[model samples]
Target: MVGREGVAVAKWLNSLGFYAFVLVHRFPNSETGAQAPLDDGRRALKIMAESGLAPKGISICGLSSGGHLGAALLSEYPQVWTSPDPEMPQIEFAILGYGPISTNAAGRTIIENKPPLPPKEKQELYDVVQPDVQLRSPAPPVFIVYSNNDPVVPVTNAYRLAEGFTKSGAPVELHIFADAPHGFALDSPKELPVSKWPVMCEAWLKQNNWIE
Candidate 1:
């Protein structure tokens, strides 16, 4: 789902002179489970650390499901998700675009409706991946963007995440567009104010010193 958008963002970031990497992971199918993407993300970070690309802390940016994955990486996770290497680079900040932070709310519907898994099984999966339940204090700063008209992921997800960050004393910035639909990405029409999200995100990154 995110492949094209991810590559586009990576190219744009690279044009701005930032070293960007797009980590691809397999999607869930009849033969595979859904947890592989999150594991892939952790391994990607570890690889970046090993490659010496991020001597300083690293920042993450994600769209849609990728955004959900980013939230998991930032929030507290079970020991199974923890890095074995103690010297792993810290996450300085995160940018999430239409991420579904509350897995119980967003996930329950999908799991119950799409999969054949029982309620008990769905609950267990939600326990492992839900960002809202896993949020911890002193988390890295976050910038979130969403559209009220988004039919895919509700704007409430943005509000919940921003609220979590505020309560945890982590810096947060949120922008809610009035009319853009879900998965607008960087292709938002010029007339729609949501098209300016990229500029706003870049400004946020500069203000936080994540970008020069």
Candidate 2:
């Protein structure tokens, strides 16, 4: 669903001189199971680290479900089963664009398939994969952008995420536009204030020394 959007963002970030990669992860479904996406993410980061392009630590920017994947990876969920690889690179920062942070709330809906997982199975996955619930100490600095009136993902999810970061003593910047639909991406109309998110994100990156 987000493949083209991911490509667009990567191209824009590249124009800004960032070494970015688009991770087209497998969906959390009956075939691949719940942990599929996050495992792909962790592996992707390991590959990026091996590439030696990110000398100054890596960053993650994800849209929608991809955002949830990034957060879950950062949160290091199912810690017993998913210990960090010895050579895994540090995640310096993250940008989440309208991620569904609460598994019981918005996230479950995203992962629920046509022939949804059995309730017991679903709850077990949710318990260990919630990013807001699992936010750890020294949380990576985050920049979040979402529309207050987003029709698909509740705006409250953004609040929950920011609150998690705050409680973890992590630096977080959140911007909620008064109105916009889900998945506007970089194509938000110029008249809509949501279109300015990229500019705001760039400014935030510069202020945090993530970019010049």
Candidate 3:
């Protein structure tokens, strides 16, 4: 969260009058592996809810892998919160910036970051952690932005996510720019159309009545 990209995005959101919280979530290489991020994100939402800083409820936003974490929170919330605590804060919406959405992409990324694991264990983990597969009906609204020319995470990830949410009967908006490399964040050149994502996202929030 302390990275330049995160700080830039947070400042931009704050300037727009949104109480943006940059979460420094745990990495997949940690002891809990892939589950570490979900645990941290859930706890962060709980804290934000108790703080009462956002009367309109909290929304999750992330770039690249961070976006995957936010999406996971929405997709896996039901199974993770089996006890059904009424007080548990739910994500009002999600904004994903070039996130890798497929299970193979996620599993491959994790394996690259962490120590080598047995093939069987890796496949099992991949099978269980697919956010697109687990996306159920009545999902929170999602705003996705990506560049078709992104070299890191393919645009297919974005397409698959949009398809998943649409199939699940959730309100979803997707914007695909013709250019812009991966991890563009808020630093995309002004000349590039991808830089308009923040403005478009703000409009989306207003359209959904999340902000005035």
Instruction: At residue 148, give the lDDT of candidate 1.
Output: 88
Residue lDDT tens for model 2, 93-135: 9899887677354334533442333654444455557888687
Itemize residue pairs with steric clashes in candidate 2: none
Model 2 Cα displacement at 137 (Å)? Answer: 1.4
Candidate 2 global Cα RMSD: 3.6
Question: Candidate 2, residue 199: CA error in Å?
Answer: 0.3
Model 2 residue 24 lDDT? 80
Higher TM-score: candidate 1 or 2? 2
Give the runs in model 3 whose Cα sits over 4 Å from its true position.
77-87, 103-127
lDDT of 3 by residue, 42-141 (tens): 7888888889798878887888877666676777553533322334566778888887666354354422454334454333334455677677467889
lDDT of each: 0.74, 0.78, 0.73
Q: Estimate each model's TM-score.
A: 0.83, 0.86, 0.82
Of the two candidates 1 and 3, the one with more favorable TM-score, higher being better, is 1
Instruction: Point to the candidate with the largest TM-score.
Output: 2
